[model samples]
Target: MKRREAIKNLMLFTGGTILFSAGLLAGCNSPAGRTFISKQDIYFLDEIGETIIPTTARCGGAKAAKIGLYMKMMVNKCITNEERLIFLEGLKKIEDAAIEKYRVEFLSMNSDQKKELFLNIQLEAEKYKKDNKSKPSAPVHYFQLLKDLIVKGYFTSEIGATEARRYEAIPTRYIGCINYKKGDRVWATS
Candidate 1:
């Protein structure tokens, strides 16, 4: 090929490649048929997390740690598309189940009712997990995913580390062997 023709061909190919990549990126950013995580959804997830890890006299629970936002971030970024669908669907199912059972939305229900609903859903998730155990490619139970996210987010948050668990901001020395106590809280650093 002539030198001028070769340079022109290379430039054309590079331009086309850049345009294709830009198009793909733009398509990804466009939320076509995508279900957005609304403020209500965040509140719902917060309620679920609070039910899973209720506030106690010692410290604040998952809700105080803002676990709903954490779950949303993880679902959007860390999980696969299929898992995200399942998680969102599970939220709807929980809402539906509440309405079916009590004729009331989950947020309106009392704490005891919330706890009961969570237990029932947890049982259902366990059953589903058992039924799908034989399938090698089966997805994880949505409740399990929710639970994991809540625990992880809560424990790692500042409130959880300092209030729920004993946190040492600066340790002078390591205790290789410490005396054991029954009701002592675990160290966050440990």
Candidate 2:
């Protein structure tokens, strides 16, 4: 190769390498690289999920279904950045509310206390929605978001589908008419 051509190619290669290296270094410091969900946060979420779907004699609950981890994944990947921020802030708010109301942390509260707390929060969310006249397109209250995530994660989990609800791997025969019972668990799939 000609000397001039060789120098030009070397410059191009060096420039490309420098750009790639800078990008890699920048990524290490990016917001995405930080750990937003700590272990404590995950445990808190698990407790919240368990409260939402307590384990019954017949089936496992949200914690057993790993609903907290599912919520984390969904919040990180599926939701918008604003929604994620709201959810993270809501966690702290829940703790604060618990402390103010019961003089104890949310995780330290008993099942009945937790249920009452959740019910109160649900009422507050409803009142907020009603007062604000929020449109359907607008974002919902963080508690609503959390409740939705918990329910979605739990019902979609393997334990929920198979144990909490009736699960039939294959329907051997289709019965058009079947007896209905008032307290029957709904079928997850037909």
Candidate 3:
């Protein structure tokens, strides 16, 4: 009887452990959960994103709210495997080009230098498209990918929703559209 009781308790413990482990794995793979992004990559992304959408005192900054993590999550969940790889490669190429052309890392480049580099890359992508008039455009371009990631990250963040759009998670039951005057604040629902 003692041996039987010990075995039963062990089985229950094993079952509980398995369930806990499964939950932990599921959390890691969850769409809402943060994705894995390198520290250097996140820093670069944050700097770029902040430049695109400057954060004021009222609005939170991209890095403060983990917009880079959101971007990574979106890329992981929404983008195809090929596109995902291409987007990551494009980011690396942007850094490589900055270093090669200006002798400085992308994040290390001055605002004007960064802007010029981005514009040059954009022009090159346009020329590439024109050159390949007969062929379908490439799956992704470096400039476009960077812009898309920055915009997507910014708009989806709390600051974007709350400050940029003035979104409110919980709004009152009654909303009077006609009563609202020009320049009046608009409330948004998620």
lDDT of 3 by residue, 30-132 (tens): 3444233455567777776766566677666666667677776767688765566666667777888999999998888887887788778879888876777
* Candidate 3, run of 10 with poorest lDDT: 30-39
Candidate 2 residue 126 C-alpha distance from true site, Å? 0.9
Question: Estimated TM-score per prediction?
Answer: 0.78, 0.77, 0.63
Clash count, one per candidate: 0, 0, 0
Candidate 1 per-residue lDDT over residues 1-190, each given as its tens digit: 9999999999999999999986676456424534445566888888999998888998999899999898888887888777777777778878898999989998999999988988898898899989998997999888887888888899999988999888999998989998879998888963
Q: How close is candidate 3 to the true structure, as a TM-score?
A: 0.63
lDDT by residue for model 2 (1-190), tens = 9999999999999999999997687456435543255555778899999999999998899999988789878886898766776787788789999999999999999999999998999999999889778576666789999999998888888998899888788879988887889888778863
Runs in model 1 deviating more than 4 A are 1-32
Q: Against the unseen true structure, what C-alpha lDDT does each candidate score?
A: 0.84, 0.84, 0.71
Residue 168, candidate 2: how far off, in angstroms? 1.2
Q: After superposition, how far is residue 129 of candidate 2 from its true place, in Å?
A: 2.0
